[model samples]
Target: MPTSAAHVPEPGEGDGPEPWPQGISRRATMRISDVLRALRTEFPHVSHSKLRFLEEQGLIETVRTPAGYRQYSPADVERLRYVLVEQRDHYLPLKVIKDRLAALDTGTETEAPVPRLATADGDAGAASARRRYTVEALAAAGGVDRSLVDGLVEAGVLRPTTGGQLDAHALDVVVLAAGLAEHGIEPRHLRTLRTAADRHVSLVQQVVAPWRSQQTASARAHADTLATEIGELCARLHTVFVRQGVDDLTR
Candidate 1:
């Protein structure tokens, strides 16, 4: 039988006890609170419920003690850290992050490995926090007209942030709008793209329906993995189609 990737530790890494508190052992365990404390400085926003929610989402797994309290191993902690960092820094959806990590664990030859950027502290980490952009800033960065930005906001493509500011994600709409302008494709022309995207979302939902229905540990993992694989496959196919079309047009 092929060895499972989850069971394989990274190369040159030992399977010795986690270097947690002096008293803790590989056989020993810690409460969710304790784990939170260990990670709080780096992940200040982390909460007990958030950890449980991540477990529920199938992003990470935890071992249970005899009393049914969660006992996270050092390996599990590392996994959780990786997941959170990816989300905070890259703005990656959980499903994508989960799939990438799983691929790493399994040692699969996938797309170029996700890039890990360096933090200000000289430690390589994900972005520390989300950045919000003002409406003016959004327009400036994307080089789009203010009217177009307003139109997108009205159409629900971009939403106003707290205090009516527009964040970077909201600014992404402006970027899209600017690109469309180059082809005489205004925001209105892109409505079809939005509709198509909605349809694709439904398609993805159907693809993951089986796993979603179960909601078990294994089910979540499978769903995350499947979503990643399908997403990657779709991206690759799209590139191939574009290349083929370009070749045909040139011929």
Candidate 2:
């Protein structure tokens, strides 16, 4: 009679802590979708385009299979997570983030707290969420005359809420319009931006519509996450395009 064989657990199976589950530990590399699934729990808004953008920015490294499929190791996922967390929590720009990453790679700095930029009043980011303004307050905050605010309202650039109040973002729009006005770009000329913003919003809604239609709490939450993520991504892309166009003019 042959002896009975003892049971053996496969890699990432049974007992020990599995940071990389679902047989990912056994695999040499994870596909983009696999990486997305692993990250979605913590970053519901992380998208394929975001990963590609990070790669293009030289922030993340990946291997390409013979067939051109991108392969990510566990380390790559960790590094990408670090980058995203720094951006989300610390509000650090990519240049600073990249510099920190470089320091880590060169063994110049260990994992430690970095100095953060702060406004005199406190965390402006947190404060801005609770800050609302009347039209007069908005004009004062923007350092613009009430006439500019009136012109912006007439041009449909600065729309107040139903409660007749403006949010922090309205102040930013007012200030930007005022600056543009100095350069002969009037608030009326900024109407195109409002129109473009609406179209971008419509695009985000269309992309998340199926998820939102599911009517489940999880699906609705996911849709909300996607909307926020895609909106920010669109804004970043627009900034990059504008910068590139400006660079071309200088060239």
Error at 100, model 1, angstroms? 9.4
Q: Over the stretch 182-216, how does candidate 2's per-residue lDDT look in tens digits?
A: 99999889999899898889999999999989856
lDDT over C-alpha atoms for residue 102 of model 1? 66
State the weakest 10-residue window (summed lDDT) of model 1.
Answer: 19-28
Please name the candidate that would achieve the greatest lDDT relative to the true structure. 2
Off by over 4 Å in 1: 1-29, 33-68, 73-75, 83-137, 140-143, 154-168, 213-229
lDDT of 1 by residue, 57-123 (tens): 6766666655667776555566677777665555467787778776665556345344332222423
The C-alpha local distance difference test score for the whole of candidate 2 amounts to 0.71
lDDT of 2 at 196: 89
**lDDT per model vs. reference:** 0.62, 0.71
Task: Please provide TM-scores, in order, for all candidate models, with all chains considered together.
Answer: 0.53, 0.54
Error in Å for residue 172 of model 1: 3.3
Per-candidate total of colliding backbone pairs: 2, 0
